[model samples]
Target: MESHIAFGYSFQAVGKGSCSTWGTGHFSTFDNYLYDFSGTCNYIFATVCDEITPDFNIQFRRGQNKKITRIIIELGPSVITVENVGIIGMRRMRTSSALKGPVKIVPPKADVGH
Candidate 1:
């Protein structure tokens, strides 16, 4: 299992059907990248971080704990994962769902036709 430090909490992404969440603000979240049949092991959860910073990522990778079995079973042996595929930045997006947060909005000035 690899540990990641995001928001403030440290989490370890372990074996098959395992998961983790490490983030501070609204734009923070993680999505499953599994490609084959949807995970039959259905479960949902949420976690809160004590602090948040702009920079957060895989804290440190240890040799023995760096097994790739979980992700391999998730995406199948033949698939490849794209860069930043499962990470979410919802808080930074401009949409109705974003309207409920602390984000500030200034309506666009109407265009005056010549």
Candidate 2:
């Protein structure tokens, strides 16, 4: 199966742009700058790094075959890891005295019979 990401302006207040990557490492930046990068390395897709601790960070790793192997997302109090094989692993962030977690959300299953 192939994975494609479509971008949009969902959070109009927080952000106002779109960036997407699809098929063989083709990427379209937020400003509509398009490019192709087929590197097999860990890449920081997006992040707010000026603060002491960022609220969110999105990253992905490509395998030697030049395909995305996995994606790791750190969103506030949760960490989500998604593998290309369709398995998603999730966890929480440990605070000074407690832990903050996310509510479980599952993706829809693919219709393989089709």
Best by TM-score: 2
> Residue 45, candidate 2: how far off, in angstroms?
0.8
The list of candidate 2 runs beyond 4 A from truth reads: 1-15, 86-88, 91-114
Question: Number of backbone collisions per candidate, in order?
Answer: 0, 0
Model 1 lDDT tens row, 18-45: 2342221111233554222222232222
Model 1 TM-score, all chains together: 0.18
**In candidate 2, how many Å is residue 62 off?**
1.2
